[model samples]
Structures are given as C-alpha cells and as structure tokens.
Target chain A: MRIPLVASLAWQDYRNDAWLSACSVLALVAVIAPLLVLFGLKFGLVSSLTERLETDPATREIIPLGGGRFSSAFIEQLGQRPDVAFAIPRTRQIAATAQVGTLVLEMLPTAPGDPLLGGLPVPQGLEQIVLSHTAAEKLAARPGDWLETRFARQVAGRVEARDTRLQVLAVLPLEAFARDGLFAGLGLLEAAEDYRDGRAVLALGWDGEAAGVGEQRVYPAFRLYARGLNDVEPLRVFFARQNMLVSTQALSIAQVQSLSRNLSIVFWIIAGLALAGAFAAIFAGALAAVARKRRELSVLRLLGFSTGALLLFVVLQALYSAGFAAVFSAGLYGLAEAGLNQLFVQVPGEHASHLLAHHYGLALVAVLGVSAVAAACGGWRVARIQASEGIRDV
Target chain B: MLNLSAVHKSRGAGSQRYSLVIPALHLRAGEQVAIVGPSGCGKSTLLDLLALVLAPDQVGRFEFNQQDIAGLWRADQQSTLARLRSQHLGYVLQTGGLLGFLDVRGNIALSRQLLGLKDDGSVARLADQLEISDQLGKKPSALSVGQRQRVSCARALAHAPQLVLADEPTASLDPLNAERVMHALLAQAREHRAACVIATHDEPLARASGLQVRRIHCRRDSDGGVTATLGEAG
Candidate 1:
C-alpha cells in the first residue's frame, strides 16, 4: 500500500490498458478545451471593448441644453466639478460667415479637448484657426498660412461686420470631422461681438450696447465631458437637478454591460453542463476500470494492502489521466485561440483575440477538481473489496 | 506458529445454515500442513479462517506466535490485523492471483514493499531459486501457468513472513509442475523457518509433499443444515 508501489502499479495498469486510458483522457480534453477557449474569448473581447470605451471621450460626453446666455464664471464652475473633465461655453452666432475674397465658409467656436476635433489642438488666439481638411483644400491653405476673412452679423435690418486676417494653425484630418467648417477660438467670438455692436469701422454705426456686459455674456450652450464613463450617470443627475438638459451615451454603455452580463451567465451555464458530462464520463470510466481489475484489486488486498491504500491507487490512476488531459487541453486552447483570432482579423473595433494566462490556470484547477471527485467515487468501490474475495475468485 | 481451538464459522440462518467447526489445530515454526478435501468441502473456508481473512462467529482460542489474537477480529482491531497481515503473514491464491499489470519482479517484491522493508536481494534470490530469473521483467500474463505459480511462491516467501498460507497453489498444473511447485514452496518455507498451510484436493500429492495432512468433511443433516469438521488424515 506504499505510494511508490501504488504509483508503479497504476502506471503499469495505465500502460496495459492504453486505449481505455486514452479514451478517458480524451473525454476530459473534449470538455476542458472548448470551455477554456470560450472563457478566453469572452475575457479578451470584454477587455478590448472596455479599453475602447475608456479611450473614446464620446462615451462620457455630456451636452447641456437650452439656448440662453450663462456667465463665464458658471462655465468655469462647471468645469471645476470633480466629475467633469472639461466644460466649454459655445455661442450660437446668427448668420456668422467668414469670407476669404471670393470663398465663403461657416465658422464655429471650439475648445481644447473637444471630441469632434479628434485630439487636434485648439486655436489659441483670434489670429489662429483650425480648418477642416476639405475647407483647407478649398482655401489652398496649410498650417501657418495667413488668410484674410471678414465676419458679418445683422442688427436692426442692417448688416454690421469687420474684416480680420487669421493664420491657419492646423488642419483637421478626415477622421477628426468629415464636415467642411472652420474651427476658431473665443477670440473669433469676441471679434464677432465687436462687429455686432457696430464698433468696427466697416460696420454701420448704431446705438447698441456691447454684447458681453455682465450677465449678457452668458453662452447659448456648453459642451461637457466626464472624467470616466462611470461618472456619466452622476454628472447627468447633477445637471438634471439644476433644471439643465444633458445628452450622453450612457444608454448604449448600459446596453453593452447588460449584454456582457447575460453572455457570461450563458457561458458559465454551458461550461457547467460540459463539466457535469465530463464528470460522468470520468466516473464511469473509473468504475469500469475497477470492475475490470477486480481480481487484481482483491489480490492486492490479500497481499496486505489496506482499503485506504487501494483507494489511493485508484485515485492515482484518475489523477494521471486528468493531468494528461489538462496538458492536451492547454495545447488545444492555444491552437484554437490562434485560429479564432485569425478568423476575426477583419472585424472592426477592439477584439479579444487571445486567451489570458490566468484563465488557463483557472481551467487547470477546475479540471483537477473534477477529476479528483470522479476518481474518489470510483476508488470507493476498490476500498470495498474484501481480502477473502481473492481466494474466492481463484 | 499458529493455534486454533473450538472455532466456529457459519453461513446463512436456520434451515439454510452451513457451519464449520474446528475443535483444535496447531502448527509450529518450520512445520508444513496441507488440508485435503474433495470439492464442496470447506477446505478453502478453513484456510481463509486461519489466514484471518474470514472472521469466525466464535472461538475458544486463536493464537499466533503465542499471543491470543481471537479478540483481534473486533472492529477496533481492524488496523492491528491489517498491520499483522502485512508484517507477519503471506498468501498465495489458487490461480496464482498475480497482478497482471506488474512484471514478475514487481509482483514478487510487492509484500516486501508493503511492509516497508529493504529488498536485501530476497526477490532476486527467490527468483533464482524458483528458476524464474529469466522471467523477472515479464508481466504475469506473459508467463506460463507453471512460471506464474513459481512467481506467486516467490512473492509469498519474499518478505520472510512467520506464516505462509496458500489455497490450492498448484490446482491447475500438470503432475510434474505440481510436484516442482510444491517442492519449491515447502523448501522455501522450511528454509525461512516459516509455518506453511496449503489447501488442496489432491490427497496423494499433499502426502507426497511431506506435509502433515488434515481432511475437511461436510455432511447435510435431515433438517437441511450442513456441518463441516476438520480432522487428521490416517
């Protein structure tokens, strides 16, 4: 009943019944390999999707609604909130146009770190502008190119305007925004305000007050971003409490979370069923092995092996088979992961394309647990063999 | 050394009862005894009882090596009996009872391995004595019937137990093989100063093997009960 003897006997028996032992190992592999691959894919894909969501500011974008002016201090206060990454005031200009000799283009005020800009730096002064690729092509301008343009605004049934020369600081790529518009700094808004008040020499003189005095300088709207997707809901609630309307992609994120949770549940259920089947197969195989070696086991009993020793012998056989199966399952998982990644190469977005090492470790532990239980069930039979049975069998 | 007196073992109840009774039996070191009986006799049953594999319903006295071991059959003494079996006794079954998975050398050395004893070249020496040296690396299934029987004998004597029990050790062998196996078994048992008890139906062979012969006789009574008794042969 010594461990060495049991091990030697178990190994010898394994070699003697190579086909049956191989069958048991294959059954374990059949259950473990696919389960590991599935888990690996799920983990990989979820991680990739999470990475994408984190990197894209749009997922955390918050747009404040209503067309009214708010003080610059209000925008600054909103930006200071812990949940807010950045908040920029936007003014809606009526008939705001830029004329470069014979070419005319619409101008929009933009802020630094705006998602629409695709990470392009914002223009820092009234002399600087960021042109869309299409707009730049139309104007025949590149970075550091000076262009002359005039801003016009209407008041009291008359047009008031001023001409300004601006330098193109950068051109937005197609991925940044496909639309044909010029992005300008707050300086442009100041120039527009000056023209609206008839302060420019080219404007028709009128007796109207300056637009940016006190509360009258409030912006029509503001673009806001959260530090992270998890902060979106809290920021939305805060904005709503202030009677301010906010827009975000929280609903899409929630939908994806729910789908991922459901998929995980389904995957575990299938894995559980597969493990149960594997347990049954391994248990049945152990039982069959016990029955086939009944005489041998009885002889061991007669040779002074205790029931515990016999049980150990049987358990050792099961562990051997499980060990082999786990190795094979790992190899098969590696191959399957490679094949799946290759198959999904053309798919867009972040793809979980490889099995993680920890997942493989977890699979090994699971297989060992399953095999141990099954082997114990089988070893119980060997433990029950009476020593006298050896003689009776003879 | 072994001793048994007024031991009783029975199977079934009432009308279907079959019982075996041994009034007294004794064996000393270096003694060889063979229980001879025809089929349907309790020869194997007696062997099992003496080997402590089958528990007797009651016993007046059961001693091994001058220690009263009759009470050792209690559940509490199970481990004690197992230890004794491993350290002090050996067994050979009728069909050789060799584990097919192990090679000849492994099979012969199993008892020594279980007892946690160093080999001391006993298995090799025994194999040489039994002319099974060439068969040591082969599995039992690869050996002939006679060769397998010799390996079983070598296994029984490997650990040098104080008592060796063999049930029909040569039941399936030809006359020549039967003589050769019995000769080797008895010679080894004597050389090791071990008491040996063999059960067989061949009375002539049992007597020729220089073993004190005892016969087991069974009779059915009118009430559908059977009784078995053991006594010395004439």
Candidate 2:
C-alpha cells in the first residue's frame, strides 16, 4: 500500500475502534495532565517566591557588621560592583542616630538609583530628607514639612546640643522601610559625624573646630543594597574577602532556592515514572491493535503493502493517540490551572499556578517523540508479519 | 508470461508434515487455467506459489516477464518479490479479504492506489462491469457474501495486473452466486489480458467456466508425511 493509503487506513481503523482509541488517548492524558500541573505549580511557586525576594528592599539589604575605616575612593569602587545596587558611605552608628519630635530616626545616606527610594528623587542637600512612613508618622511630618533634628557632640570639655531643621523631601512607603529612618544626601550624614567628632561642619557653618585639620573625608562603614537576593550571598562573600564582615538575608534566599531545586527533582522523578507508564501503554496499545488486525494487515501486505508501509500504518495510529492526548492534556491542564489559580490566588485573575506557551509546546513534542518510539517498537512486530499468513488465513 | 518447473513447498514438520510439488506449468497473457482437486489436496498452495507469496523450496526454473524469478527467490529479494506481487500480480481469496474500514470503491481502488496510479476510472468501470455500481458506496460488511466475492474480483483486476490468482473465490457463495462470481472473475481477467489461475475443488464448475483444468493428487509418504503434486489432470 502507498503511504497515503496506509495513513488513511490507519485513520479509518482508528475511527472504527473509536472507543478503544479514546481510551488510549485518555490513558496518555492521565499521564500528561498531572505532570503538567505539577510542573506548573513548581514553576509558579518558585517564580513568585523568587520575585518576592527580588523585589523586597529588606532582602536586598547588606549591612556592615561593625564600623571600619573605609576611604571615599574605596566607597566609590564599592558602588561600581555589579552586585551592589546602591552603596554610600555611612557614619558611625553612634552619630547615625538623631532625635526628631518624639522619634529617634537613623540617618541613612542615599544616592541615585537607590532601590529603597523606589524611584523617588534623592534628597539634594543637607536640609532635604526622605522620611520612612513610621518616622513620618512619629514626627507627624509630610513632604515640605520642616522638622528640628538634634544631635549632641562633646566639644573640648563641653557636651553641646546642636539643632538643624530639615525639610521632608518625600515619604517612603512601608515596603521600602518599616522602621523609624530618614534618607538623606551624603553631606548631612558627614556633617553630623564631623560635629560628633568635634570637627567643624563647614558646609553648615555650625562650627566648633575646622574640618581642614589636615584630614580627608573618610567613613567607617557603608550602607549597601544588593542588586537582588542572588547577589546577597556573593556580596557578603566579597566583603569578607576584603576583611570587612557584612550581614544579609542569605538564609532566606537559600531556603527559597533550595525549595525550587528540590521541587524540580521531585517533579522530574514523578514525570519520569509517568512517562514510562505512558510509553508502555502506547506500546501495548500499538501492539494489540496490530495483533487484532493481523489478518487485515496481512491482506494489505499480500496486496503489496511493504513491511515499511505496514509499520507506517501501525505507527500512525499510535501517533494520532499521542497527538490528540497532548492537545487534550493541555486543555485539561488549563482547566486545572484555572481552578488552582482561583483556589490559591490572593486576588481574582492573579493566578499562582501557570505554564508558559512553550511549556505546552514542549509537552506536545515530547509526547509525540515518546509515542513514535513506542509505536515503532510495536511496528517492529508488524514489520515481521508474513504476507503468506494473510493469503492462507483469508 | 510465466513458466515454472520443479516448484516445491512444504508445511509443518515431522509427523504432521505436508508437502506440495508443482513439476511444470506454462502460461501466456490472457491464458486461463484452473487447479481442480479435493479439499485436502494442494490447489491453494499452487496458486500461492504462482502468486510469488509462497517461495518454492527448490525450483529448476521459474521465469516471469523474462525475469529470473527463481534467482530472485534464491537471492532472498523480498522487496523485489513484493514489488512483483503489487505491480504484476493479483489475488482473490475465498473470504474476499476486504478491509472492513474501506467501502467497495475504496476496496477496488486500493490496488491502483498502491502503484500511485491516478484514478483512470477503472474503479468505476470495474464496479459497473461487476454489476456492483449500486454497492460502491457500501462497506464490505454491508455486502452479501456473493457481493463481497465480486468486490474482491474487482479489486484484483482493477490494477490490470499481468497475472490474476484466485483461491476458492466462490467457496462461500451459493451455486448461482458462485457461477456469477467465477464468470465475472474470468471475464475481467480476460478483458484485462491477464494470465489467470483459479484454485477450486469443483472440477465440473471449472470445466463449465471454460478454464483449462489442472489437478493435484496427494499420497501418504513413508515418513508420516503427505506429498501433493500438481500438473495435468489425473
């Protein structure tokens, strides 16, 4: 028989045994549907967890363990590191804290592209400050509001209280920082540390002694945020190599990464077993169909259907089942995914369970490949059937 | 079209062994011959050998269309043999052997389709000649036993093969239907200028159909086997 004839014959016979063909399709669907759902859940879970870590300012923060001498040039170099999302010199912890209206807010030095600012403009001068929501609430401050900030320093033998008023540049959302803090430019923080060290704050002209006492600007630590959670551990390692210890949210990052890896391993194990079962089902179905229609196939063989043609005939049916099952499994997976998304979503239409378009395409290709191999195994038996057998029996 | 000498085949083994021998036969294009024998004889076996399906155990000479068929068998040219079967030979079995999936038209057109030949209207023409024009749309399962036999005949001749072989083509039909099927098969084969071989147990029917008669005789062998021979009528 010709290839076209064999293909048509395979289709007709498959239609003739429509019930049985449907059963085979369902068997393949049973194998594929769970695998798709499992992978989708794994992918979605890991993706969202990783996205949450990536987007959170706290997770990206890398805090120096203690104050150490760091030069201005070194801080510049630190800012250029690929893992460093934002790096600016920070004053000693003692001087970093200052008093506002019934609130002690830590002054963090922020520069351009600071993730904490979340696209908010950096404070331009010593008088401008970005207050965290809690700090703003505590001081009852809003943008354009001026608040008195007090910092005390011992000058010679006297403890003097110096006061400066700062205008709030912006109010940061709680997701950026939940604590009592204020974001300001480098000059304000430097001047506060200078005043605490009994040096003149020449920029503010609030002097005790001159800052040009043969000293260049230097910092004890840096305020840094990593590019992402993936950068946190590496940045911590980089800091340690420079003899500067840092702390980060590395543990949480590891937990999420490990969860993703373990989930993948489990998914693949289950998928492998399911695929093996599917292959067996396809193989047996192909073989049984051939055996059931042995006389018909043999007659085809006698009528000049070559071994190759006969093999094509049998394999075509198996492939049809696999192709149909792949499509149906995708549909079933879609339904299950919708149900799962609705079941677990925090908001409607925000699905936690999902699969990309390529994933469905990959599944179709894989099922077709496996079915072809399995059917070819069954086709091997068909290829061996003697045409003489067809003549004698029929 | 074909010449054979010393063609032989065997089935079973030891105590249940059955063997068949075709000493010699010659046929030309459009020639008609029938192998007439009892049921236990090897009439079907002879047809199978001539159809190139049953390979002869040993053949002194077997030639078809000036090609060395005996050499092809000796060299294990299976593909070549299958090609010969498809392109140059046709067979009608006792059971019609119609694929249940295809209707009567599909059944008849199958042979030409195998050769990748476009519809030369032979399927419709054969259906008309076999008086199965009305039944062309029906599946073989829907046809009566006699109708199925005629469909099988149409399928065999539709390709206009050089040789047509029929093994008890009317075995399952009533007497009147049997005569009709036999006549149709012969008429189509002759119309197509095909060399024809019919295997049947009914000698009177074979002679009445104007087919030159051949015969097969079987005798028990000393080794608990039976040997059957085919040639001129005993």
Candidate 3:
C-alpha cells in the first residue's frame, strides 16, 4: 500500500487517541505560522525598497551636482552607452518658501514625466502649477486660478525682489500627494530665482546676474532606469571613471533586500523550531497510537502482515495528519495575510508596480517543507517497528 | 505432534551463562500436560522454548510433526512460528492476558483475525461458550479476574490452536476464579482436540484437571550448569 494511505489510517488511529491528535495539530501549526510571518516580512521589505529605488529619481542617479542648473549635456552621452537603457538629466532644487498671499508653501522641484511621481498629476505648460491638495486648499486655489510664488534674494547686504507668481496649473491627487510632493519643470524654480535676483535671470547669463551671483554653473541629477538592477552598478562605475562624483543609492535597495532576506531566514528558523515541536508531537502521537493498538498490530503480524504492511499503516497515518494540516495551514495563512494587509496600509498606488513584489513564494516553500518534514517524523516509528515485539510479548 | 531432543538453553555466556537443560520431550496430539515445578526451575523457559517464542542456545533434532524446526533463520522462523502459534498454540498468562486497549470482543476477534479466521459466528459462538458474551464490550481492566481469564481463554481458543500454553495462568486469581479459568481453558482445549500445557505450581488445579502432570526440578550440576530434571508429578 502507498505510505500516504497507511499514514491516513495511522492518523485516524491517532485521532481516536484524542490527546495525540491535538498535539500533532499543534505541531503542524507551529511549523506553518512562523513561515507565513517570515514570508510576509520578506515580501514587505523587498517591495518597500524596490518602491524607493524605482520611484525616486534622486536615488536612481549615479551623480547629482549641486545647483539649480541641470546639465542635459551628459544625457546624450550616457544614453549612447551599451549598458545604459535610459538616462535623463533633470534640474532638481529645494525651494524653501513659495509664499502665496499669507500662505508659505514648500517647493519640491522634479521632472515632468518621472516615473517616481506616479500618482501625482503634473501640468504640461508654464501657466499651470500642480499644487499639493493641501497647498491647493491652503491657497484656496482652483485649477485655473493664478498663484504667486515669491522668493527673497540676499545679494551683498541687501534683499532684492521678493515677489513673483505662477498660475495654479492643477490640483494634485489628494491621497499621498503631499507625501514628498514634487513641483515638476524648472520654470517654477526659475521664476523663484528671478524674484530673488530683481534682474531677470533666464537663459544663460554672463555678467551682473545678481549682486552676489557669480559665474553660472549647472547643478544636475539624472534618472538612469536600466532593465535590471545589476545594470545600475556598471553605469555607476562608468560615471566614476569619467571623474564625476557619482552616488548611486543602490545600497539602499541592497539593504532592503538583505533585510528582507535576513528576516525570512530568521522567521523560517523560528518557524522550523516550532515545526520541529509539531513534528515531535506527531511522532509521539503515532507512537501512542501504535502502543494502543499493540495487540492489533501483533494480531496482524500473526496474520502474515509483513513489516512492510505495518510500515505502510503508520505512514498512512502521518500523511493523513499532514495532508489535513497542509490544507488548514494554507487557508489560515491566506486569511491572516489578507487581514494583515487590510489592517496595514503602505500607500494608495502601491499595488501596480512589479511582478514579484508581493508574491508569497518563499512562504509557501517554507510551510510545505516544514510540514513534509513534520509528517515524515510522524511516520518514522511505524517504519522502525520490531516485528517480534510488535506481534507479542512472547 | 511436537518433539525436542537435547535442548540446551542459557542466558549470557561463559561464567555468566545460566543454562537450563531439558534432555528430551515429546507431545502427541490431544495430550494435555502440566509442567509443575518449584520457583526458579526454568519451567517458564521451557514453555517459552516449546512455544518457539524464544530460541534455545543449542538443540539437536528439534522438530514438529517430522518437520525440523532447528536452525531456521530468525526472520523465516518468526513468520513460521507466528503462523504455527496463531493456528496451533495458545498462551494464557496470569496477569490478564487480554489487552487493556481492546474490549472483550476485540481481544477475542484479534486471535481469529491473526489466524485469518473471518467467521463472526464462530467468534460469537466461542465467546458464548467462554461465558464472556455479555461482557464483550468491556475492556480487560473493567472485567473481574474470573471474567478476564474467561475472555483470555476465549481469545486463546478462538482459532482452535493445536497446543495451548498456560504460564501460571491462574497464579494471580483466587481459588474459585483459578478453578473456573482452568475449567474453561481445558473444556475449550478438549473441544478443539488440542493438547494443553500448563506450567504452574497450582497442585489443586494440577490434581483436579486430571491432565498429564510433569514436574521440572532445577539443580546446580558439578560444572555449575543448572540441570532441569523432568518427570511425572504424582
């Protein structure tokens, strides 16, 4: 007979044993629970880190220069490299204040079509300003409404022009729009710089740009979206060899992935220990069942039951316990994962990213592997039975 | 028929060897014999050897009905002995031989099952004859000594074995329970036309049963070997 069939019978006998049945079930659960938790943590960390890498351009770049001027000059050069798929130079600056009437808003400048600003709405023209939902509400500004962004320049010992305005282009999505919300295109930053300089600072300037202003230079950053994360390193090296100060935050990605990997290992280890306990319980249960049926087993031996038959019977019992436990654990783990996900919200557009982000492949492997081991342990005693002793005391 | 010639049994070896020597023994079909002896006479050891439950240290020409049983491999011997014992030999122990996990019926059914006897009526009829029909659902622990003994007798005789071995089957029972157990056992043995071997010091049972009685006496020989002398016991 198949060992699984025999294990099923043994499991039935174990169930009749009552106390042993409970113990075996407990062992199975112990093994499965930790594996599920570890799997969840691994997926969570990996997803969070990948989100940071792919969504934030600053983190993806190999080099970020200091200043409002971004050199699109290297964009054409970097794009020609065989290893690089897409590289786009972007003007990024931190504006301390965007004063609209009595309201002062935080200005974060970003690229117009960056993948990182996925959920936020960006405008196509200079007349439009994409206000954060909070900023829109604070300024009482509508999509078509015009808003002024004033900047004060400190040149020499004097304050220059302090006022400027940009049309409120569009209102961003209310959900997570304020979470590091970006104002795309360099026009807004340019307008703010113009307000500081008093004299118009547009296009390239040679002399008398501002009282304290020196020669113009470009402060630049670029987003390099390669086909794979492995491609990120070669590009980093290429940029470094060119005498450029390159900084790729791929280490952050590695840190997240590593944390996820470590957490999974820890979870599986803990889960494995619990599973071992469960397996022991199942083994003990099988032993007790055999002990209870000592006379029956003896009788079977007398009836020409080969030791193989007895082994089959025991194996069947274990399979039965494990099979049931597998189904139960899977269902329970699913329900728990769903409930946990519902209870914890990471972000709104967090779903539609990559293929491997939230998958519980590791967890599945852990649960099944542990369960199989546990079941095998339960059947060990049945296979090792001494025919003489099993049959009778004589 | 069973035969044993120059059967030498011992535990351990060399200076520690505790040997029991039974020169020759034979039992024809339908002959009930009792092995009566003092304590530590190796009566149980002889029974164990005869039952083929344990192998002796040495034996010359050991056979059952002309079939040589000596020198059979342990694995083959175990299966062969199990079949022979299940079908032809019954053992009745003193401390409630019926398993505690099994009810009276299960205990009885177990023997028939072992013997590959599937007839429920035969089992039911035997249980009725043993006077344990009403207590078939009760475990050995739940039954009185006399009832438990009767259940054991039922199980032992369920498949109608050729020889029934009783190892002090009544030693733990009261006089009445012991007599009842013996009477039930002997009656079943007779019904099956089987030989009964009762290894016990119960003289009352020995005398009243009217079965052939053989006494085994153990004494240390000059060489320090324990010699078991077998003879007719009054």
Most DockQ-accurate candidate: 2
C-alpha positional error of residue A182 in candidate 1 after TM-score superposition, expressed in Å? 6.2
Q: Each prediction's DockQ?
A: 0.58, 0.67, 0.10
Chain B TM-score of model 2, please? 0.96
lDDT of 3 by residue, B1-234 (tens): 888778887876544556777777888888888888887787777777776666777887688756566765334565566556666777765555555655678777766665455776867888788787889877677888778777777777777788788778888788887887888889888888888888889866887988788888777766665667676445
In model 3, where do residues sit more than 4 Å from their true spots? Answer: A1-223, A227-247, A264-394, B12-18, B28-31, B64-68, B73-89, B112-119, B159-162, B190-195, B203-210, B223-225, B232-234
Model 1, span B67-160: residue lDDT tens: 5677888554656777788788888788888988789999999889888888899999999999999999998888899999999999999999
lDDT of 1 by residue, A298-323 (tens): 88777777788788778788888889
Q: Fill in the DockQ of model 3.
A: 0.10
Where does model 2 sit among the CAPRI classes? Answer: medium
Model 2 residue runs over 4 Å out of place are A98-102, A144-152, A157-167, A347-351
Ranking by TM-score: 2, 1, 3
TM-score of chain A of 2: 0.92
Better of 2 and 3 by TM-score: 2
Better of 1 and 3 by lDDT: 1
